[model samples]
Structure formats: structure tokens, C-alpha cells
Target chain A: MAKHVLRVVAVVYVLFLLVLPVALIVWRTFGDGLAPFAEALTSPSALHAFTVTLTVAGWAVLANTVFGVGAALLLVRHEFPGKRLLGAFIDLPMAVSPVVVGLALILVYGRFSPLGGLLESWGIQVIFSTPGMVLATVFVSLPLVVRAVVPVLEELGDEQEQAAHTLGASRLQSFVRITLPGIRWALGYGVVLCLARSLGEYGAVAVVSGRLVDQTQTLTLFVEERFQNFDQPAAFAAATALALIAVVTLLFTKLLRPKDRSDGN
Target chain B: MAIEVRDVNKSFGTTPVLHDVSLDVAAGSLTALLGPSGGGKSTLLRVIAGLERPDTGTVRISGVDATRLSPQRRNVGFVFQHYAAFKHLTVFRNVAFGLEIRKRPKDEIRKRVMELLELVHLEKLADRYPSQLSGGQRQRMALARALAVEPQVLLLDEPFGALDAQVRKELRTWLRRLHDEVHVTTVFVTHDQEEAIEVADTIVVLAGGEVVQAGSPGEVYDNPANPFVMRFLGPVTEIGGSLVRPHDIEISPDPVEGGSPAVVSRVVRLGFEVRVEVEIGGHEAWVQVTREQADRLGLGPGDTVHLRPAPGARSLVLAL
Candidate 1:
């Protein structure tokens, strides 16, 4: 009897907090027989926003994957000064508000700053551009891969790596052959999460991107602009698309959960 | 190839693990570094394998200085206690790893890997992943994987330490037979005295970061350099500043002349033998006797007896 009550309570809680809001938005999106949904999503500005979101997310996930794997290896495998500090800093983005992150990036890399001026002189723009947007996305999602890979790396000790070394494997060869494959599922899970977060990130990208319509606008920003302009149909359609993407990413994450100890086929 | 270490000293964060240690292993001979845990046995084995560099000494493999060489360049095979099977590869690929790294021909790799798998008796499970194998099977696979490269030297750090006693014994005998057939210069670290005795032709006794004695198994067991090595090898009773093994001391309740008069303090019945601990001249000495002998004597606490060394039995007396 108590178990049934708890189960019903959980169902009700999920219905209100998650399912109801999502279902309403989805219903509102398809209420007009899919015509407005297709027309709003197929617009020039909406399509441009989507490509921009994909571009930023692509670069951010790539950068985060490389940096996260390296940081996890260093944290778990080596001992040095300030290792704990570095680990704690990797988690800073998750703790701090994304808006603050955007402001911090602007403070350091804005056009008037020294480093920004240097980079601008080299014909590379970092602030209020695609580079700044990628930077913000990368900073916000930096800890995902590292957190995913660190525990797995710790559980997987250095014994096999030493064995590989004794078997005459070069350092790169051992990492490519042994270390990377060992962390495949965890890495995939992290990548999926990072992609999800990058696509949905708003405050940080808003501050860093300057919110140029059809230029640096992302799908998320497009939704906000459409809704504020009283174009609720387009806004609801974009929201439903993002919801679909998040659901897909959730499914991927479920499948990529690192439970099985795989040694290849 | 032979191995030589000269005055090797190692310290981890100011704590010395191996100090002034020197050793020499003959070519194609099986050597065991036998000692208690934390006695630097594994550290010394790693030093010779080029996994750990010595602080103030040199390591030579087949006359080549390997002090600064990386393990990859040293070409030594190392096996760990936990059987470091590549969890991402099948048994066949795990055995074929070294050959593949060396980029041998595909056909040759298959033939050599199959040969090693059969040698280790894992050919039937070649397609199985490490996660699907038993602990003993994984360890056997690890050994075959290490031997695949035909390394100049093979080092094992407590290779059977994770297995049960039955499997450990089986692997010990198997290792000896395998060494006889392959004859690669090998050095294994083990804290099991009986294992070192039963498997190794030469035993190097280590204690507290130093090599106390290095000789044949019988020599190290019969003649220990200090109390630590004496106690580390096996159980001994201290009598008048001399250590005598239980089987070395003879107990006679018939008042034998020239023997110390003693009282039987305790009698313990272990498997296959009865241990009679006797107090002799205010010193404790253990004597081993058969069950029938113990029963006939009816020895118990407070019984008077005479204790003396058995004929031709080696007793160790450490100078204080």
C-alpha cells in the first residue's frame, strides 16, 4: 500500500514538473495541423539560428572532449602541486551562473582587453563573435567529460598500461590502443551531455554572442526573440524541436551509460 | 640475457624503499626475490625491468646499461598480481598485443599467438574477453601475453598472489616447467617461502630495503644472515641467542646426557606433524615430533624433558 502511494506521488510529481509543460508546448506546436510549425521552422532566420547552434556546439564538444580527457588523465594518473585545485576549478562552471561566465569571458577577451587586442591584431576575433560563443559553450560544459571519465580511469588502474609499456608499446600507441578504448562508453556519455547542454545554453551565449539576428543567433535565442515579438507559434515550434533533441540525447545517454566492462568484440 | 644491478638505491618521497641493493641473475635461470611485503622485493624487480630507475646505481641487461632506459626500450615482460589483461581485447588479441605492436605479419602474429595460447592452455577460450574469464585463466592469459614478445627477460611481481592456494601451487609448478622449456632469463618476486623454495633455483632473501642474503634456496633457508631473514623464511624458536627450526631440535624425556633439561611448555598438533614447545635453560625451543611419538611420550605442560639439536641439522645463531 505504501509503495503504491509513493509510486503515485512520483508519477504526479513528474506529470506536473515535466510532462505537463512539455505536452502543452508540443500540443500548442501541432494545434494548427503542422503548417505553422513547418513554416516557422523553415524560415531563413530560424534555419540560420539552427546552423549557428550546431556550429558552436560542434566546436565546443570537440574542444571539451580533448581537454576533458587530458585533464582526467592528469588528475587520476599523476600527482603534482595544485592537482586538487585544478580538479575543483574544472567544476567551477557547473557551480557558477552561466551569466557570470559570459561576463568573465568578456572581461578577459573583449576587444579593448590586451589579449583580445593582440588576437584582433592577428585578424582573429574572440569577443562578440562565433569564437566568443564557442568559448562560452566550452567553458560551461567543461567538467562533463572529465567527471564522466575520472571515475572510470581511477577504477582502471595503471597496471595494464605498464603491461603495454613492457610489451614495447610507445606512449601514444598505448593510449590509442588501451586507454581510449577503455573509456569509450563514458566518453560517449559525456559527449552526449555536453552536446545537449551546448545546444540549450542561453544566458552565456546571449552575453557573448551580442544576439545578432540571422547572424550569431542560436535556436534558443530565436525562441526568446520570437516569443517576445508575440510570434508564439514560431516560439512554440522551436521549443518543441529542442524538446525533441533533448529527448534524443537522453536516450543516447541511457544507452551510453558505462555499466558493461567491454573488452571489444 | 643476464641481469645485473649494482648498488641500487631507491626512495619514494624521502622514504627509502631499496637501499644499496645489488643482485646478479644468470642467463636463462629462474630467480626469485623472496621477502615479506614492503621489503622492496617488487621495487627491485621493477628496477631491473626498467619500470623504476635506481637512485645511485646502474642496471645492466645483457651487458647493456638500462638505468635510463624506458620499459618500452628495455624489452622486458612484466606481469602483475592482478593479471593486467587488456579488458578491451579478447584473449587472442591480448596475447597478440606485443606482436601487433611490433607490427609483425598478420599470419605470423596469428601463428605465434595461437602457439602461446596453446602453451598456456587457453586456445579454446581465445575468443573470450577478459571479463568472461576466471581469475586463474586471466593470470594464465597474462603470462602468455607477456611471453608473446619473446622478451630478453621476464619479470613477475607476485604473479599468483591473487589466486587461491590450490591454483597458486599449480601455477608455481607450471611456471617451473614452462621456464625449463622456454628458458628466458626470468626474475619473480614472491613473499611465499615455500613457493620460492619449490620453484626457484636461486633465491635472493630481502629484508627492510636491503639484500640480506642471495644464494640457493637451501642455503638461504638453512643459513640466514640475520634474525629478520631467519624469521621471514619460516617459524623458528629462539634458544640462548640461537634460532633453531622446530624440526631441528630434538626432545627426549629419558634424560639424555649433555642435553639441556627442559619442561614441555606446550604441544600443538599441526597437520602431518606435532610441535612440542619446550623451555630449556630459561629459553624457549620448539621441537617437532611425529604424532605417535608425541602420544607415546604423553607430553603436556609441566612435563620434564631434555632438548638438543638433531644430528646434522643446521641451526642459525645470530651474533648480538
Candidate 2:
């Protein structure tokens, strides 16, 4: 009887934390009618917001993938002065609040800042623009990919690489053939996490984005604006879209990632 | 090809592992680096293979100065203790890896790989991955892979250490025949004296990062360099008066001085001989007598006997 009660409590705990919130969101999204969902999705503002969000998210994810893999490979394969300090700094953005990321981005790219003013002269405005939003997203989600990859890269010993070299492979050839295949799975996982985090970023991009309708505003900001303006159905529609995208991306990752070797295949 | 290592010194952060270690392996000869674990045998092999750099000295293979060359350019084949097979590749591909990396023609690679597999008698399992093979089969595959490159030198680091006794014995015999067939300069690293004696033309005994002795297997066994080599190489028993082989003492009704009175503790029949354990000076000493001697004397346990060292079998080892 006690064991049964424990199992019930554990399931209830999961439902309270996970299932309940999803259930509430689904209920809220479908509460009104199909017309509200269709109308909200077809709006020019919604379409603009989605396009801007995708452009920013796509750029942020791409930048993070390159920089994160570079950082991870450096931390794993090489030793230099202050290497541990450099590694700790990679995860610094992750530990900080997203709001802090926005603030830092603004401090570095605000109009008063040297680079920002220089870019402004070139008419390439960063702060309060789409570039600012992408920069903020990248800053906030930077360490997610690195953290996912560095440990796996570290666990892979130099033996295979050495064997490749001894087998007459050049350094680049060894890396391309032997080392790359060893870390490809981890790289895929890291990229998925980077994309997901960048797509869902809110506070960082919100602070940097000007929130102008059909301009710098992102899908997340559009949802927030709709909710505040009492456009409840529109807000649910945007939330449902984000949720759908996240679910699909996660499912794709699950399907495509290599099968778990622990399953004894 | 002959490998000449001169004054090779290696230190791991100030703790010297191999100090001025120099050895010569003549062409087409099998030399066994016989030593206890941590005696720098593996380090020396690594130095020769170019996996490790010597602090000072030179490794030359057939007149090529190999000190500055990388492992790949050294043209030396290495078989690791655990086999170190590429877990993902098939046996044929594993053997073909060196040739493939060398950018050899595909037909040549296939022919060479098949020939090596045939040499090891594993041609049928060409398509099977390393994980599917047995331990002995994996070792043979490793050997075949090492041989596939047609290397200038071959180094094996305790190749049969992980196998069962029967498998080890079989492989040791097979390796001796393989060396004759391949006619390559080979160095086998092992702490096992029996394996060294049974496999190699020359046995180099190492202790504390230095070569204590190097000679033919029979010479090293018969005349050890020191007490360390003596005790390390063979099962030694100490009697009260002197160190003697179990076969040195005879069963006779004669009591001699420089000899002692000992009580027979136990009698063990060893088929061809009887080993009699005697308690002398509060310690047990084993004495072996042939079956004829034992039968002539009617000797058994709990019989008091006078122990005398045979002059012919008595040899003194200077204590280190």
C-alpha cells in the first residue's frame, strides 16, 4: 500500500511540474474557436514577427554552432595558460540571467559605445534592431552548445587520432576522418540545443529589440504584446506555434541522433 | 632492418623512467625485453616506435635517424597489450588500414590484407568486426594488422598477456614460427621469463630503468648477472647453509658439516622425482630426489635427514 502511494505521488509530482502546464496551455489555445486561430496566424504583424524571429534565430544558431564547437574543441584538445579560466568563462552566460545578457549586449553595442557608433556611421544600426536581437540570443544561448559538447569531446581519447597519424594520415586528414566521426553525434546534439534555446529566447532579445510592429519585433515579443493588449486568442495562437516548432525540432533530433548503444544493438 | 637505440633517456616530469638505455636489435632477430613491470621495457619500445621522444639519444633504423621522425614515418609496427583494434572496422579493413592510409592501390591492399589474414589463419572472418572475434582471434588480427604494413621493425607489448595459458603457449610457438617466416626484426616486451626464453633468440633483462643483463636465453638462465636477475628469472629456494637447487641434495646416510640436521616435514611426489621438505634453522627447505634415489632409500615424510649441498650444483649469488 505504501509503495503504491509512493508511485502515485511520484506521478502526481511529474504531472504537477510538466503535464499540468502543457495541458493548461493546450486548453487556453483551443478554448475559443478555429476562426481566432486562423485569423491570428494570417495577420501581417504575425507574419512579420515570425520572419524576423526566424532570421534572428537562424543567424544566432549558426554563429553559436561555430563558436561553441571551436570553444569546445579548444578546451578539450589543447592546454594553454589559463585554460580552466577560459573554460569557466564559456559557461558564464549560461549561469547569468537572460536579462543580464541583454544588458551586456546593450552596454557593448549601444549608440554611445565605440563599435556601435562606428556601425551607426555605416548605417548598420545594431542596438534596438534585428542584429541586436540576434546578438542577444546568441549571447544568452552561447554555452548551451559548448556545455553539451565539451564533455563528450574530452572523454574521447587521443588514441584514435594517434592511430590515424601512425596509419599515415596527416593531421587534418586524421581530424576529418577519425576525430570528426567520433564527435559528430555530440555536435548534432549540441546544435539541436543551440537552435532550440535561440528560438525560444525572450528576455535578452526583448530588451534589445525595439518592439516596433512589423519591424524589429520577434514572434515572442508579438505574443507578449498581444497578451498585454487583451488579444488573448492571438497570444495563444503565437504560443501554440512556438510550442509546435519546439516539439517538431525535438522530435527530429530524437529520430536522427544515433541509436543509443546502451540498448545492446 | 636493424634497430639501434643509443643512450636513450626518458623522464616523466623529473622522475627518470629510462636512463641511458641502449640496445641493438639485429636484422631478422627476435629480441625479448624481459623485465618486471615498470622496468621501462614498454617505454623503450615506445621510444623506438617514435610514440615517445627520448630526452637525449638516438634511435636509428637501418641507418635512418628516427629521433626527429613521427611514428608514421618511422615504418615501425606496434602491437599494443590490449590489441587496440579499431572497434568499428571489419577484420579485413583493420588489416588494410595501414596500406589504405598509405594510399596504396586497392588491388594491392586487398591482396596484402588477404595474405596477412591467411598468415594468421583468419581469412574466413574477414568481414567480422573486432567485437565479434574471440580474444585470441583479436590478438592474431592485431598481429596481422601490424604485419600488413610490411614494417621495418615490429614491436609487441605483452601480446599474449591477456590470453589464457593454453592460448598464450600456442601463440608464443606460433609467433616463433611467424618470426622465422616474416624475417623481420622483432622486439617482444614481457616480464614473463618463460615466454622470453621460449620465444626470443636474445633476452635482455631490465631492472630499475637499466639493462641488468643481455644474453641468449640459456646463458641468462644458467649464469644470471646478479642476485636480482637470479631471483627474478627462476624459483629460488634458500637452505640453511647456502642457496641450492632442489636437485642438489641427495638422499644418503652421511652427515656432513657446513651441512645441518633437518627434520623431514613433507614428501611430495612429482612423478619423475620426490620433493622432500625439511625444517632446518626454523625454516623449510625443499630437496628433490629422483624416483630411483627415493625408492633406494625408502624415504618419506617425518624422517630426520642430514642435509649436504652438492659441490657441483652449488653456485653463489652476490646479494644486492
Candidate 3:
């Protein structure tokens, strides 16, 4: 009886907090007709925002995937000084607010900072540019891949790798043929999570992007700008697209989850 | 290939796991490192295989110094207790992995893998993944995969420790037959005394990270060098200055003229043999008797009995 009550409460909470908001956005985007929705989607600024979001998120996911796998391997396989410190630092992005992450990046890459000034003089713009947005997205989603891959790597002890080594496989060969294949699912799951988080990230990208009209404004910022300008149709259309991407990513994550092998055939 | 380890010492952090361990395994002989858990038997096997580096020692394979060599270059095959078969690869592909990495011809790789699958009796399930196989079948696959590289020496760390008793017995016989056919120098670690006695041509007994004794099974059983080996090989009772095995003590209801008076403290029936515990000379001693003898005597706990060491029974004199 208590379980049923709890289930109802959970279902109602999800409907009000998640399902209703997304459903309302989709309804509002198509309420007038397909004509307005089409116009909103094909608008130059909307298209540009999408391109910027995808470009920054794509690079961020790729960079985080490589770093995540390497960090997970080091944490699981080796014993070195400051290993615990490294692990703690991996979770910093998760613990800190995304706005704080954006401010931190700005402090490091801002015009006044020596490194930022050097890069600026060399015509390599970081703050208030695409690179800055990418940096913010990477910082916000950095922990996703590492947290996902670490448990799987630790669960798969060094036995298989050692077995490969003893079977006359070199270090690189063992990692490529054995370790990578073993952790492929975890890596994929991490990539999907990082993708989702980076796509939806707002505060960090906002603070770093400087909200340039159509150049640095990502899809989330575009939605905020459209809503502020009282263009509900355009805002809903953009938000619906982001929601669709999130839904697709969630499905992909479910598909990539590791299967339980204990149920014998 | 013959393998040698000299003065090998290994320590994890500040705690020592292996101490001054030395061993020599002959070519094409099956050896067992028999010891209880935490005795460093597995560590010694890994040291010989180059999987674990000893702090101060030399490992040689077929007279080649392998102490500083990596496991990849040592040309050793290691089988883990959990049968670390690749989960994503089919049995056939797994067996072909080593050969494929070595860049062997495709046709040769296929032929070798098929032959190994048949050898391990998994030809019918060659396409199946490790998750689809039974524990025994997975272990057999692990064995076949290790042998695919034709390693000079094979090291197994408690190969059958994770299986049921029935499967363990069957695999033990199968492994012995496999070793006989291949004639590769093999060293396996096991805490089971029966397994070591039955499967190994030579037994190296270890305790507290040290080699207590190494000899043929019969020799170790008959003439254990020290108290640790005697107690480890089987149950033993220290009487006066000698160590006596349970099977060597005779139990009778009638008071023999020269036998010691004792009370039957416990009687345990173990299929063909009955173990009778007797209290004699202010100490407890175990006596093994046949079921028929036990039935004839009709002895139970708290019954009076006489105990005597059988004539010609092997006994080792304790050295202080």
C-alpha cells in the first residue's frame, strides 16, 4: 500500500516537473500551425545557434572521452603519489556550480591574465569566443565520462590484461585488443552522458560566450533570448529540438548499458 | 622449458608476501605449489611467469634470464583462477587471439584455433561467447587460449578453485591427461593437498612465504622434512618425539598388553573409512579404521579403547 502511494507520488512529480514542461513546449511550438514552426526552425539565427551548440558539444565530448578513459585507467591500474588527489579533482566539475566553472575559466583565460593576453595578442581568442564556449562545456561535462568509466575499469581487474601480457601481447596490443574491448560499453555510455550534459549546459557557456547575437549564442542561450523578446513560438521550437536530442541520447544510453551476463543461456 | 627462480623476494607496500624463495622446475614436468592462502604460492608462480616482479631475484626460463624481462617477452602462459576469457570474443576468436597478434597466417591461425577447440572439447561451441559457457567449459577455454601461443612454460593460479567439487575432480583428471599429452613445463598453485598429490609430478610446499619443502608426492607424504610440512600434508598428531599420521594409529576395544589405555572421544564415519578420536596420555590422537573394523569393535564416543602405533608405520622424529 505504501509502495503504491510512493509510486503515485513519484509519477505525479515526474509528470509535473518533466513531462508537462516538455509537452507544453511541443504543443506551443505547433499550436498555431506547421508554417510558424517551419519559419522558426529555418531562421538564420536559430540555424546558427544549433551549429554553434553542436560544434562546441562535439569537440567537448571527444576531448572528455579521451581524458576520461586515460584518467580511469590510471586510477584503476596504477599506484602513484597523489592518485587520491587526482580522483578528487575529477569530481570537481560535478560538485561546483556550472556558473562557478564559467567564472573560473574566465579568470584563467581573461584578457588581464598573462596566458589569456598572450593568446589574444597571437590572434587566438579564447574568452568571449567559440573556444571559450567549448572550454565551458568541457568543464561542465568532464566528470560524466570519468565517473561512468571508472567503476567498470575497476570492476574488470587486471587479470585479463595480465593474461594478454603473459600470452605474449605487448602493452599497446593488450590495451587495444583486451582492455579497450572490455570497457567499450562503459566508454560509450560515458560519451552519451557527456553529449547530453554538454548539449543542455547553460550557465557556464552563457558566462563565457558573452551572448554574441548569432555567433557565440548556443541553442540554450537562443531559447532564453527568444523568450525574453516575447517570441514564445521561436523559443518553444528551439527548446523542443533540444528536448528531442536529450530524448535520443537517453535512448542511446539505455541501449549501450551493459547486459547482465549472469542469466545463463 | 625448465624454469628457475633464485632468492626471489616480493613485498606489497610494507608487508612482505614472498621471502627468499628459490625453486627449479624441470623441463616438461608438472609441478604444484601447494600451500594455504596467503602462503605466497600464487605470488611465486607469478614471479616465475614474470607477471609479478620480485624485489631482489633472478628468474630464468630455459636458461634465459627473465628477471628483468616483461611478461610479454617471457613467453609464459598464465591461467587465472577466474578463467579470464575475453567476454566479447567468441571461443574460436579468443583461442586465435595470441596467434593473430603474433601475425601468423590466417589459415594457420584458423587451423590452430580449431585444433585447440577440439582439444579442449569445445568445438561444438566454438562460436559461443564466454558468458554462454559453464564454469568448467570456461576454464577449458582459458586453457586452450593459453596453449594457443605454445608458451615455453605454463603457470596456472588455482585453476580449479572456483568450480564445484564434482567438476573440480573431473577437470583435475582432464588437466593431468592434457599435461601428459603436451609435455610442456607446467606449474600450478593449489591449496588442496589431494590435488597436489594426485596431479603433480613434483610438489613444492610453502608456508609463510617460504618454501618449506619440495619433493615427489610420495616422498613428501612419507618423509616430511619439518613439522609444518607434516601438518600441511595431512592431519598429524605429535606423540612424544615423533609425528604420527591418523592412518598409522591402530584402535581396538580390547586392552592390548603393550597398547596405551585411552577413551574413544569421537567417532566419525567417512564413507569407506571411519575416523575415531582417542584420548591417550593426556592428548587427543586420531585413528583411521576400516568400516568393518569399526563395526566389529562397535565403538562410540566415551567408550574405552586401546591405541597403538602400527608396526612399520612411517613416523618422523621431531627435531626439537
Candidate 4:
């Protein structure tokens, strides 16, 4: 009886807070028999937004994955001074707001600053450009991969790597053959999470991207612009698309990540 | 290859783990580094394997100074206590890893890995992951993987320490047999004195980062260099300010020539043997005798007795 009550409470809470809003948006997306949904998603500006989102997310995930794996390895496998500070800094992006991250990037590289003016004089524009947008997305998604990989790496002590060294494997060969394969599933799960977060990041992207149509606009910024322009169909269609991508990412994460640390795998 | 360490010293941070330790392993001979935990046996083995660098002195493998060599270049096969199996790979791949890194031919690698698996009795489970195997089977595979590299020296750091008593006993016999067949110069670290005595041709007892005694099992057991060595090798009772094994002393009801006065405190019947505890000058000592002898003597608590070294038994008698 208590279980049923708890279940009802959870279901009703989800219905009001999440499911109802998502169901309403999804209903509005397909209400016009799918024509507007298809048309709005394929428009020139909407297509450009899709491409931009993909490009920024791709670069961000790539940078974070490499940096995250290296950081996780250093944090878990070795000891040095300021180790705790570095670990806390890695999770800073998750703690700080995305808007603050964008503002900080702007302050450092906003063309009026010394470094920004120097880079601009060197014919490299950072703020109000794809690079700044990628930086924003990377900052907002920084901790996902590191957080995912650190626990797994910690569980895997250096015993096997030491054994590999004893077996005449060079450090690089041991990492590629033994350590990398050992952390493969966790790394994959981290990468997927980074990808999903990078795709959906909006506030930072909006602040850095300047919201220029068909230029720096991402899917998230494109949805807000369409909604403000009274283009509800296009807005609802893009929102539904983001929701679909997130759902797919959830499924992918479930399949990739081990359910729990059972079977010693 | 024979391993020689000369005046080697090692310390972790400021805590000394090995203090000017030195020993020699004969070519193709099995040596056991036996001691209690934190006795630096494992650290000493790592120094020999080039996994650790000694702060002072030298390590020579086959007459080559290996102190500065990286572990990868040392050609030593190290098997850790927990088996350290590659969890993601099958047994076949794990055994083949060394040969694969050396770029041995595909056919040669297969033949060698299969031969090792057969020797370790894991050929049927070659396709299974390391996690799927029992602990004993996992360590056996670890041994096979270590041997796959054809290392100059095989080092095992408590290879059976993680297993239960039965498995540990079985693996000890199996390792001795395997060493006999392969004739590789192997050094294994274990705290189990029985394992060392039963398996190693030479036993080097370590305590407090120093080599207490290094000799054949019989030599070390029969004649320990110090009290620590004697106590570590077996149960030693302090009597007359000296340490002696329980079996080395005999208790008599009346005083005899060269006998010390004592009083029986307890008679413990242990299986087929009888242990008599006697107090001499306020220090307790254990004396072993046959069951029939104990019955004939009819000793009990508070009974007066005298203690002397058993006939032909070489007891450490500086004071006992």
C-alpha cells in the first residue's frame, strides 16, 4: 500500500513537472500532420543551426574527451602537489553556471581585452565566433567525461600495467593494449554523455554566439529565436528534436554503462 | 639467470623499507624471501626485478648491473599476489600478450600460449575472461602469462597469498613441480614459513628491513643466527634468557645433571604430541614429548620438574 502510494506520487510528480510539458510540445509538433514539422526542420536557417550545433559539439567533445582521459589518469594514477585543487577545478564547470562561463570567456577574449586585441590583430577572431561558441560548449560539458572515467580508473589500480611492463611492453603499448581496453566501456559512456551535454548546451552558446541567423546560431538558440518570432511550429519542432536526441542519448548511456559493478567487469 | 644484490638500500619517503640488504640467488635455483608483513621482502623482490630502484648499491642480473634499468628492459616476469589478470581479455590473449608485443609470428605465439595454458592446466578455460575463472585458476593463468615472456628471472610476490589454505597448498606443490621442469631462476616472496620451507631451496628470512638469516631451509631452521630468526622460523620459548624451539627441550620430574630447576605449569595435549609448559626463574618455556612419555611422567600443574636440552638436539643454549 505504501509502495503503491509512493509509485503514484512519483508518477503524478513526473506527469506534472516533466511528462505533461514534453507531451504538450510533442503534440503541438505533430498537430499539423507532420508537414510543418518536416518543413521547419529543413529550412535553410534551421539546417544551418543543425550544422553549427553538430560542429561545436564535435569539437567540444573531442577536446574534452582527450583532456578528460588525461586528467582522470593523472588524478587517479599519480600523486603531486595541488592535486586536489586540480580535481576541484575540473568539476568547476559543473558547479558554475554556463552563462558565467560564457561571460568569463568574453571578458578574456572580447576584442577589447589585451589578449583579445592581440589575437584580433593576428587576424583571429575568438569572441562572437565559432571558436568562442565551441569554448563555451566545452566548458559547460567539461566534467562529464572526467567524472565518468575517474571512478573506473580508480577501481583499476596499476597492478596490471606494472605486470605489462614486466612482460616487456613499453608504456605506450601497455596503455593501448591493456589500460585503454580496460577502461573502454567507461570511456565510451563518458564520451556519449559529453556529446549529449554539448549538443544541448544553450545559455553559454547564446551569449558567445551573438545569435546571428545562419552564422553562429545553434539548434538551441534557433528554437528561442523562432519562438520569439511567432514561429511556434518551427520552435516546437526543434524542441521536440532536442528531446528526441536526449532520449536517444539516455538509451545509449544505459546500454554502454554497466548497470552496476557486479560480475567484476 | 643468477641474481646478485650487493649492499642495496631502499626507503619509501623517509620510512626505510629495506636497509642495506644483500643476497644471492643461484642460477636456476628457487629462492624464497620469507618474512612477516612490512618486512621489505616484496620491496626487495621489486628491486631485483627492476620494478624499484635501490637508493644505494647494485643489483646484477646475469652479471649485468640492473639497478638503473627500466622494468620493461629487465626481462623479469612479475606475478602479483592478486593474480593481476587482464580482465577484458580472454586467457589465450592474456598468455599471448608478451609474444605479441615481441612480434613473434602468429603461429609461434599460438603454439607457445597453448603450450603454457596446457602446462598450467587452463587450456579448457582459455577463451573465458579472467573474471570468470576461480582465484586459483586466475593465478595459474597469471603464472602462464608470466612464463609466456620467457623472462630471464621469474618473480612472484606472494603468488598464493590471496587464496585459501587448500588452494595455497596445491599451488605450492604445483609451483615446485613447475620450477623443477622449467629450471628457471625464480624468486618468490611469501610470509608463510611452511611454504618457504617446503618449496624454496633457499630461504632468506627478513625482519625490520634486514636479512635476519639466509641459508638452506634446514640450516636456517636447525641453527638460526638470532632470536628473531629462530622465532620467525618456528615457535620459540624464552628460557634462561635464550630462545629455543618447543621440541628442543625436555622436561624431567627430578633434577638431573646440567638440568635447570622448573615447575610444571600446564600439560597441553596437542593431537598425538604432548606439550609441557614449565616455569624456570619466572620465565615460561615449552617442552615437547611423546604421548607415552608424557603419560609415564604423569606431570601436572604445580608439579616440580627440571628442564634440559633433548638428547642430540642442538638447542640455542646461550642461556636456555
Cα error, candidate 4, residue A165 (Å): 0.7
Model 1 per-residue lDDT tens digits across residues A171-255: 9999999999888888999999999999999999999999999989999999999999999999999999999999999999988
Each prediction's DockQ against the real complex:
0.75, 0.37, 0.58, 0.69
Give fnat of each prediction, in order. Answer: 0.86, 0.25, 0.75, 0.77
Score each candidate by Cα lDDT.
Answer: 0.91, 0.84, 0.90, 0.91
Candidate 2 structure lDDT: 0.84
Models ranked on DockQ: 1, 4, 3, 2
Q: Per-residue lDDT for B211-279 in model 1, tens only? A: 989999888888887777778888888665678787777778777765678888899999779988778
Docking class of 1: medium
Total backbone collisions for each predicted model: 1, 0, 0, 0
lDDT of 4 by residue, A174-239 (tens): 999888887888888999999999999999999988899999999999999999999999999999
Compute each candidate's TM-score over C-alphas. Answer: 0.97, 0.87, 0.94, 0.97
Interface RMSD of 2: 2.9
* lDDT tens per residue, model 3, A27-83: 998899889988998899999999999999999999999999999999999899999
Cα error, residue B295 of model 2, in Å, equals 5.3
Candidate 2 local lDDT, A1-265, one digit each (tens): 9999999999999999978987777788888767778889889999998899899989988999889878887888888899999978888887899888888888888999998889999999998998899889888888877887787677667765666666666777777766666666677777887888888889988888867888988889999999999998888889888888999879867964654231111
